[model samples]
Target: MSNIDIRHAHSLPPEQARQAVQDVADKLADRFGMVTGWSGNTLNFSRSGVDGHINVAPSELHVTAKLGFLLSTMKGPIEAEIRRVLDERFT
Candidate 1:
């Protein structure tokens, strides 16, 4: 398994940050068939080959994921897409 951990700083309020995370989750669910739910300030997501959570705070969002063998090989693109989404939504 491969792990990805990313922390992005943002200036949005807590609710807006959570909404941004939710939007990102919705997009991932639509594009990648991911299942997602919120637990407190954390948005958890999973699929066959990936599992992750995004933790939302007033000033930061932390994303962490574990990739299964097959997906591990594509980690670069996966992480890049995640960063792109975060950049678009939070920056």
Candidate 2:
């Protein structure tokens, strides 16, 4: 398995940051058939070959994911896409 962990800092308020995370989750669900839900301030998501959670705080977001064997090979692109989205939404 391959793991991706990213920490991004943002200035948005807690609620706004959470909303952005939810928006991102929605996009992921639509694009990748991911199932997502909220557990307090954390957003959990999973699909056939991936599982992950985004922990939302007032000033930072932590994204951690584990990619299964098949998906591990594409980790670079997947991580890049994630970073791209985070930059787009949080930076």
Estimate every model's Cα lDDT from 0 to 1: 0.93, 0.96
Task: List, residue by residue over 1-91, the lDDT tens digit for candidate 2.
Answer: 9999999999999999999999999999999999999999999999999999999998899999999999999999999999999999998
Instruction: Provide the global lDDT of candidate 1 against the true structure.
Output: 0.93
TM-score of each: 0.97, 0.97
TM-score of 2: 0.97
Instruction: Determine which window of 10 residues in candidate 2 has minimal summed lDDT.
Output: 82-91
**lDDT for 48 (candidate 1):** 100
lDDT per residue for candidate 1 within 1-91, as digits (tens), equals: 9999999999998988888888888988998899999999999999999999999988899999999999999999989998998898899
Distance (Å) between predicted and true CA of 76, model 2? Answer: 0.6
